[model samples]
Target: MSARDLVHPLVLLRRFASDMGAAIRVGGVRGGLLATCLLAVGSLTPAYLPQSSPYWVPARALGLDSWWAKALGTGMVIAAVGLLMIAWFNVRPTIYVGVKHWAVLLWWSLPLLLAPPIFSHDAYSYAAQGWLVHNGLNPYEASPSFLPGPFADQVAWVWRYTSAPYGPLALQISHGLVELAGLNPYYSAVLHRIPALVGVALVVHFLPRIAILMNVDPRGVAWFSTINPLLVIDFVGGAHNDALMVGLVVAALYTAYRGRMFWALVLIGVGTAIKQPAILAAYPIAVIGSGWAGWHVRHLARFVVRLAYAFAVSIGVFCAISVATGLGFGWLNAVTVPGMIVTMAPFSLIGFGVQNLVNLITGDPNGQLIWKIAQTLGLVLSAAFVVWYAITRSRTRPVSFLAWAYLAFASFGPALHPWYLTWGGLLLPLSKPSPRVWRIAAALVSVLLVYDAGNMAWRNDLVGLALAAVAAAVIVLYRRYLRGHRPLAGLGYHDEEGEANA
Candidate 1:
């Protein structure tokens, strides 16, 4: 036997175990195995059992009765805290890698892969629009309240009272399904989940491709992109349409990187059909068409031409869908009305300041002017960032484009939802690590928002205290880490080559 073969098997096993322990100390759990599972269960509990359901007895017994939904919300906070701990302690690198690791990851994420549709009554809006189309009424021109059923009035207050601002194409499609399904909200909700799952699946599939295109390690991409806790909880569990938009955006980038410009434009067009925010990706396409290394007037012209083509195709598709489904175009304009903006974690800056200002200036505690100002700032800053990035950065991906787009929308758009931040979270791994503290702070704040959204009573003081504490912690941790203190030594920096370009 060779000298190596002569070594004892137990000795090798012991060495392997030691190395794994060290890796976990550094990288946390690479797949976020345990955290993802906890978050999945925690976030979906409210969906399966309504707040008034008897299943909440256990939660009430545990002091979560103020809002039975808070039981799940509290659990999510604990899971997020666990994730942060894992991240803070740097436990991923030491985690075992191989089929066993992947199995655990899959096991955790699978329960969430298709958990019964829960949270956000937005899906009901989609169902209502579909029902409208089924009844041969233009969904764009009519609000859910105009319909004649319990489902119509059951839409979330924001959607029921507000004019429809969503692109008509998605509504038209949903309406057609409503016609086919005969006014079943549950069925419509399930159908909407199909696209949502498709979006998540697309991300999982294209992530490896994205890593390859960026010349980064596929393993890093797999661990960081597909299996992150934020991605699992926000996209998979929350069932937000932004997840699909993100998937399409990423696919477009992957196609463009492969020189499939035509396909990329088509995908971007489809994404815009789903949500108007996706139109921002056209900028990155223009950048790519102009070539990565040089600036040419001819290239700029070509970029504009490509952009025009994308816009035309997107508009055409949307119009066709509208006409086919009898959903008029009026809904496109309805999405812009000012309304109660929920406090999403990143956008909470506006919520905190605006709510207080309104209370102070008008002596009306429910005033929303401060939110308006915060949104204005968010728009101004986001626009500035996009302009600066276009001028300074050589490589632009769809994720980058979508990230900035969603940031602008969250900041300036009429309403905010904590799950909306999922858009940015999905793309976070693609950006530079310099913003790690801000991102982590955003995630923590999101946990608080989830809690606030679940429990109405906590709106006043509990949420505010939580937000302040999180913000303060982020500031302290950032200051220490910036000084080379290794505040998160167990989470050793795993810098992929050329990541700076992304």
Candidate 2:
């Protein structure tokens, strides 16, 4: 190769860096950039690091276990969430046109690229599962605890004995990453995040295209979906495979919306091979394929055909991956593993409460029947809602239908995590929701961020929790003061043109 050939790539790299730098210098992007940087630094504290992790040793050595480190890290992360929310609301399609918005995402994501899993230890389970697969074991049948090694030690205790409930493709990918990491537990956990980043990248690339097709503001969609704190904390920071699944579902939805039914179904199939919940995406795809003109019976045949095609394609992909990975069908039986824990899910909570009440009244404290009944009832109700919405509302707003369906699944399922909400929350912006809907969504996001951060601190260190509360209180009071005084520019409450739009 000539010297000019070698220098050509370098020139392009430098030019790209310069352009991104100029973009970041804009005041509109600074808040989010600074927030992500803060999040990255805060994540290095001992609280965020897995206790059994090799990564935690170094953090402890750095005196990050001190009260100040704990409190400050907690505060920084909470403050980062607040700032990111503010920055997200301020993002206007008129102002952050095109790649400028992407530039902001790049800056925000860069800091979290290598951080330890935040808010969850599920990534460690990923490492152990990959280790099992690498050792010629079926993760669907064997818990991580079977081996009793470094990898197994890193998984959360509650899940260490639970068989893998993830799809075969995810296990295969995990095996490859674990093998690539030389079986080192920490690196395996960190390397698992690569798939998540790929998923996030796919969403960043396709969500805007989908939005544009639906006549929504592409920039707004990008900002809402990509900069979502839930995405950052759960998918990227916690390294959840749902990122890959959601990314593929978004791409499939885009293709289906664009009239490529076969390809859309294929993408949905592949996505289902990563996580079963992704199959829910096919309902919307089928609706889009039907070319709905009205509630008339004319589209019924097309819808059924499309739905059947989706089912066939998804089942084929699922079985193909199962056979290819030699992990046949065991995951189907293991799918209920997450339900072992009673979470804040609407039905789970009700069941627990009812069980307690019945036990108190009947003097049978060991009773389990009531809880099981409530859980089953919740699943049935959630399923009924999904079917009702798919039939009644999906024809007009297919994407929104899918979003609400996923939300129903989360709320009424056996367990609900903050990240579960993102499955639907990410799609709301693309549906052209009303201003009130945006307000509600934003408020939920803010509340969840604070709760998760506070909960983490409460679990790990009470002192940190108190300090974090103080920090949050200060921010809340300051925001009130700002509202009373001069308007905060770029926050949508006061735009450049002096409109109080928010």
Candidate 3:
């Protein structure tokens, strides 16, 4: 009840950081919690809120619908991302951030968990799809727009008419949540976060165990993967089902490493039923089951047999789930639905650029030649890498190698979302990535966080984007000139030279 009591927490946090001997003047843990709080508050703005939400009227009454208010929200987001980057970079293996950090991570997530959908409205679409199934209409056979009600109204226009591309288990879960919410769209959307939260819990439990299997520091893995800004923002805040899918995939990997291939394959099958990319986890599992020693002609037969067994078991489980849900392979037809969106994936961007260039040169805008070719090439390249990694690195560096394979496919495929990157980035810590690699990954995570907010701003309100850009530029200037290149001195500890090579 006293002012000192209220003030002591931050001071205590600072003291704790100092005791830990962190290299930075401010602890990453503290900064990360602050950033999450900022993001939670900023996420209430019009740019992030669903236009159909009942909160908008109240927001409008408070002048939160104003251009300046949107820009302010954007600015806050930019600042939060910058602070999070600084915090993550300061975490050192020497500090041994372990179980206590889990509490901090959970504390940071509370605000986000209570916030409305932040970066995306996909949860709205999820609710609508569930509504479709509840009404005895197959989601895979129909779009949300077909129903045309409160639920469909909440979906973003781009996906309004798209059939569900998610697996049967995902759709069934959504359907169940929707029914449990009494068919209320907003509540349904909120309830949809259950799967994501469960997935996050799974990751928190299993990632450290997986890290142990790779002979890496559990603290390191926990810090890098669990505290990752991208995972926090997109998976938790955005309420993407990829959270559960990737979590199941991680759990399956752990089970495989524990020498229980049957259970591992079953987990992989369940994960694949949540999202298709999870099926790819079977390759490494198959390699593990084959008892890989060294590449030899004789080993090829065993590898093939193990791979076949994996595929057969996983496919059976996937089919069983499909049959149980009565969704029955309709999702197979909708699997390519995501590719309909022209995103910033490497090949998609290239194809879009070439398509535009061709239109400019020919004065004709209907050509789809180069775009299709580029997309096909991306698929081919992704498949090639999958095969190459499966054959070569599956035995020696299975976790890291498979992580890169997932990332390669996501990056090169026709669609790339920030959450998609988390599928692989979460595994990198277990691989003992070098400091340089960590730095690069940190930079990517920072950019991705900004990109999600900026993209939303650019599409919904240009003024917001401009303000965010200005804020970003100011932060860069401060970090480069005002702060200089020196390590922070007041709080925790970092060894710049050690980290540079670590």
Show how many residue pairs clash in every candidate, following the order shown.
18, 0, 8
Query: Model 1, residue 369: displacement in angstroms?
Result: 5.9
Q: Which portions of model 3 show Cα errors greater than 4 Å?
A: 1-27, 91-99, 463-502
RMSD of each: 7.9, 5.8, 7.1
Which lDDT value does model 1 have at 57?
Answer: 71
TM-score of 1: 0.70
Task: Rank all candidate structures by their lDDT, best first, as comma-separated numbers.
Answer: 3, 2, 1
Winner of 2 and 3 under lDDT: 3
Q: Runs in model 2 with CA error above 4 Å?
A: 1-15, 66-68, 91-95, 294-298, 360-365, 463-502
Off by over 4 Å in 1: 1-91, 94-96, 99-105, 113-119, 176-183, 296-299, 337-339, 345-374, 394-402, 408-414, 435-502
In model 2, the number of clashes is 0
TM for candidate 2 is 0.88
Across 1-502, the per-residue lDDT of candidate 1 in tens digits comes to 5778648797778766765454444334543545555554554444343333334577567665455455445445444444543442343332235332333344445655544344455666777777766766666667777875655754666677555666666776676666555666655654676566678778777866765666544554455556554555555655667778878877887776677767777777777777766667766654554443335776557656766776676566656665664555675466545344544434445556757866987788766656666666666677787767666552444445556556556644545665555555555555434445444633454454344334431332345544544565456556645665422122222332333234
Per-prediction TM-score to the true structure, in the order listed: 0.70, 0.88, 0.87
Between candidates 2 and 3, the one scoring higher on TM-score is 2
